[model samples]
Target: MDIFTLTIIVSIVIYIFIGNYAGRSVKQIDDYFVAGRQAPTLLIVGTLVASVMSSTVFLAESAFTYDGQMGPFVLFPQMGTVGYIYGALFFGRYLRRSRTTTVAAFFGERFNSHRVQQAAGLSIIVALGGYLLVVTQGAAILLSDLTALTYTQSLLIAWLSYTAFTLYSGSKGVLLTDTLMFLLFMVATLLFTFYLVSDLGGISAAIQGLSQLEHKADIASWHGVIGAGTEFPTAMDYLIWAIIIDISWGIVFAVSPWQSSRHLMAKNEHVVLRASIYACIAAGVLQVLIYGIGGFINLANPDITPSESAIIWAAKNMVPEFLGALLLAGIMAAALSSASTFLSLVGFSASNDIVRPSSPKKTLNLRATRWIMLAIGLLVLGASLFLPPSIFWLTYFVGTVFASSWGPVAFMCIWSKTITASGAFWGMISGFFLNVIPTALQYLELIDLPSYMDPILIGAACSLVVTVLVSRCGHVSRQEKVYRMRLHRTPAGERDLKQTKISVIAPAILALYGCVMAYLMVTFYVTPYQTASGQLLPNGQVDWATGEAFLSVSWALLYIPLALLTYILIWRSYSPGAKNIEQAQTKA
Candidate 1:
């Protein structure tokens, strides 16, 4: 066998070994679900980063960037940085403090309703199922190109490798193995990116080449880039839509099951807070490096078609034999890390949230979780093999489902006391259907809508409005009102005004930072000036001079400060006093 294929085989073996080793720790449901709630900050950070940066980002987003549908550096890194920071301060810490094992369980406790928990769990399954299909299909396509296997055969290999560890080892195995995979992928990505840049002569040469290309204007235009010239439709084509999608999707993604569960696994709220900083930094640096490589590769070899194959093609054609093997292994690592996490999540939701809640048997629950993991793996594998769709569309569909259906309810549960159980439940259900039904119709060519009217935006608006309206119309009982008031209380005690101020001020500062960055992006990157004839120009379609200015200013002024500020805010929020407060709460 070739060195690349052999390396991939060895990596798969190592992952299975690690999963087996980790499985020894799983004697109980707690260990399986949340790693016994004893994971340190670094493991939590690693797992969170690995789980959140899935094949979608490495394969699909890189493909989109290679095709010039969006600037990965401009969009993804900023979104993640802002999202995780806000999540750590507002959602992560508080959610961990609530001591819930799952996001669905948190909804149950927050609203005192089991039905709401079931609804939340079902929504998670649907959304995560869609995400898993995308990851699997993306991996299968890449593997098919690399090996002589058919897509179905490639998918079976990928699915079995992903499921073997998850079914045996549970959360402990998943997290530990995910950390190892994170390291492997990080190294491979750095090496591949370095080689790509060097092979293109340099960053300056790459950019210049890209600028001189025939599609230079199209590539640089943020609001008008197409996919493979025609095969994929333009989804993000306006400045306002891009801004909203990035920030909104970022926040929802941070609180999603695979990401937020890391907070629960942490040793303490302080770990959750600190690990958020670590995850943000790692994600920001890696995204910029890898996506920069994608852009440079496109510039070097503009003839690489199908766009999604750009990264794989660069690894094979541009790197040395051994390094190329490692790069391919890294891609495998990315795919498995994410797939394993989602598999485990679906299992946990199935057993703990959906099944065990009604049946209430510990041993049966444990066995059932394992079985469910296998079932989910097979189910998603079947979907990928039989009903495969384009990577971008699948991701967009699932992302919208999660963002619109679960996003509003999750935010309100953590931050607001007035959202009634009825409102949360109905709002989620309504938002889900409203988003899915129209998109399904659109997919079937039975209806058409304005290009700019994204389903996610509409669904989120409708969900938010319904939630507020229903909440206002309903009344909480005296006892439940008091319970909610307690739920909102700071662990440091409400008497501690200093802690309260810190809580409020941290998010406020981050919000200010996000707003400033948005303003800068709009002013420097998205705005369009009129021509000499007084005709208006299209946004994000700038002249060469304007493009140079935008790139230079954004590189120096925007991302650097945003990164630094994120670190500072996280450091400040995880004070010794915060730990003391948490300890005191534990004692109480």
Candidate 2:
């Protein structure tokens, strides 16, 4: 066998071994669902970053960067950095304090309704189904490109590797394996980036080459706008849509089940808080380097198609054989980490929220969870194998669903007390349908909508509006209101609630960052620099050299420092002394 196959096999074997070993520690439902709530800061950080990055970072985002330009690539990580900070401030401590095994369970408990919990679970299953399918398909495409295996065969192998480990180790196995894989993936990504830059004769040469392209202004600018009749019909549409997408994605990143689950599993609330900082640092650094490689590759060879396997194409053609294999392994690791986490989450929701809520025996619940995980793994695998590749659109659809359906209700539950159970439930239902139905109709060619009307924005707005209006119309029972008031308080008093530094500062920081990003984007729109016409007389154009300088200086002076400040604030505010009220209730 070639070194590539041998290396991949060895990595898969190690994953399975670690998973099986971790499985031996599973003694009850809790152990399987939340890793006994004992995960440390590093493990939580690693798993969260690994799961969030997924194959999208290596496959889909790379392709988008190559096809569209560096504008979105630079914007992507900035959104995540803000999202992590938002999550740390708004959800991290509260989720840990809630002590629920899943976000669905938290909804159930907070609202005092099993139906809401089940609804949330079903939504998660649907959204994650699309997400897992995309990741699995990306991995399969990479493998198929490298070897003689067909797509189906490659998919089956990917399925078996993740399913076996998930069935054996559950969340513990997923966490441990994810940490190890994250280290490997990061190192491999950095090495790949280095090789790509060197092959292009260093960063300066790469930037110079990009500047000489016909669409150099668009490629280098944050708004990706070019001459009067460029890709976007109007420059404002591009700018507005770009900002909306970034903000929507950031909100989803903050509150998604995959991320909240990590918070639930941490050793303590402090770990959860601190891990967000680490995750932001890891995600920010890696995204800039890896996506930079993608943009550079497109500049070097515009002939390369921006397919789902674009990064793999870069790996095979730009790097040495051994390095290429290692890079492939890293991509595999990215897929496996995300697939395992999502699979385990589906399993946990199925058993704990849907099934075990009937109060089944611990042994029966544990056994059922494992079986459920296997079933979900197989189901998603089958779907991926049969489905046409739609990684980019599917990712957008799923992200919108999760963000629109869950974001408003989740924020209300954690921060407010006025929302009734009925309001939350109906809000989710309305948001989900409103968001999905329009997109589905559009996809089926039954409806034609204007390009500017983003379903995600409309749905999220409707969800928030419905939640507020319905909540005011409905009233919570006195007992439920009392329960909510109690939930809001802590042993350290209301000061503990008020002491969240992130909550106080993040909004201001987010606004400032958004303003700065908008300014940079506006500069792109007005700038008249175009290699197509080579027109220096327009005065509206900013030359490629000037654009590149602005981008470098803004990224250095504005984006990086803001990200670092957010991290430092989160670290400084982490309080180990804060107590978990829900854990106290459990012990009692």
Candidate 3:
């Protein structure tokens, strides 16, 4: 017990050290909001990994993987790649294209409308809050699982620690601690995966065991079982949803605030691409490893919670004491890294999204923002304790909200120049509520929506139809569209975006990684797809030779080189005096 407390204390101390390391970075609002727009690509990648991957990838993904295959949650990892790529290839440029602090603020400036700003702000709040709650809940669960700490005690510690870190250094603090947390978690999870997989006797016997227990007296397949209560998504359905919603949410969610926040915080347009491209790959790797551990654990211990802590369990029951302590440290790292990210979002959203201060005293405004962040942390802790949600479900729920609201809004705003502010607002409002209404209905036992299988699909469609019809009928014209497209003077630093460093490498790397994943589709099913068969895990080990040949360890190795190539290609690919993303991002 003392050793376990020592592990947590050590983790907390590391976070504090990182926070202090990031000091001397918060001199202005730009620094607070965008991390001075001068963060190195590596640091940007760290923050992105820490933030976007967050609690869901750490705990929720493990939870789901423990009981089932990654199922539709595989989309969670795949979308990590997709979201970052979209942000780098298109959304990042557009965000910098518009001269505003928050994405919502940009809408108001570009369209000359406050309603659009408000709508966007509301969406940002929901997305940010939901994400924060998800991470906070995971942290609470961690405390409960590992020690005698009550859910509330764990939540308070998680929230307060994260809030205090942000209050001190803003994004600088977030970036520094996030990097440490990332490194710690990755190494720890790798160790855990290695031990867990090895324990099952070189993977083959593991598979044999899994096959023997496949049915477990439950429904044999999806055809036999139906609904969330039965066992979440069945096999075929999980695979199909994994591809469809996973793909859509990947691109759509990325374009909005989640990845955009990182892009905005990046040192330069180049950093945006570099970070996203690498962050995507790292996130994917993290998922594969955690799920692999999940698979191996359940293969050995048949009855595990959806929130799988098999690594910890295995360490206690199977491994030596010192190694078990190390494994626990890694789990804490995963949880802490995620907590820092949520802290950053909650702070940034409260400061910029919900309440954008126009006060002249920059220092005073920053202090106020810090206070708001602390408040938000408390709120998140409360939410986590009171409204504990299943990790995968919470993640999907938040993704659905983001897709329905910001996804379509960003698409129309960036690509369709004729999109009116009111039109965009209404589109988002309708789409956003499409999700909320259904949720409320279900809660009240009002409607019989088949399942949570496609909440975002319906919401996104509604947003599109309403906005298009309204835009055409009420205000926009063909001429206005053309006129808006005409290149206005770009922002101060962004003379030409295509010529920027991101244009060359990020896209190709992302495209290639996707191709390889699709072509071979790795044979080792660490995380079994959730099905009606009582969430049967893949008990058997897969022979690497029998698996798809495309899944190389170097899944997205070229992204780094591609990013370097992007730097050089900038000279050839684009023109000057066109778009000044730097100047735009540098300003408030």
On residues 1-588, what C-alpha lDDT tens digit does candidate 1 reach at each position?
A: 878788888999999999989999899877888899899877987898788677777777777667664343553335645567667666777778777778788777778788888988998788888888888777777678888888889888988888888899899999898898889988888887778778877654555455445753455443336555543265444454556567666766567777887888887666776677667667766776766676667666866778778888887788898898898888888888988888888877877677534343434457777888788888888778789557776677776676778778777865666789889988898888888888788778798765556677778778889998998989655654555555545554223434334434443444444456455444533332212212224553434354323443453355456545654544444443544432343235
lDDT of 3 by residue, 71-131 (tens): 2233233544556765565566557544356677666665666677777777767777777
Candidate 2 lDDT (Cα, 0 to 1): 0.73
Q: Name the better of 1 and 3 by TM-score.
A: 1
Model 2 residue 415 CA deviation (Å) reads 1.3
115: Cα error in model 2, Å: 1.4
The better candidate by lDDT, 1 or 3, is 1
Per-residue lDDT, model 1, residue 525, is 33
Cα error, candidate 3, residue 156 (Å):
2.1
Error of 1 at 40 (Å): 1.6
My TM-score estimates for the predictions, one after another, are: 0.84, 0.85, 0.80
TM-score of 1: 0.84
TM match of model 2 to true structure: 0.85
Off by over 4 Å in 1: 70-77, 221-236, 356-364, 478-483, 486-588
Q: After superposition, how far is residue 459 of candidate 2 from its true place, in Å?
A: 1.1
In candidate 1, where is summed lDDT lowest over 10 consecutive residues?
A: 527-536
Query: Worst ten-residue run, lDDT, model 3?
Result: 217-226
Better of 2 and 3 by TM-score: 2
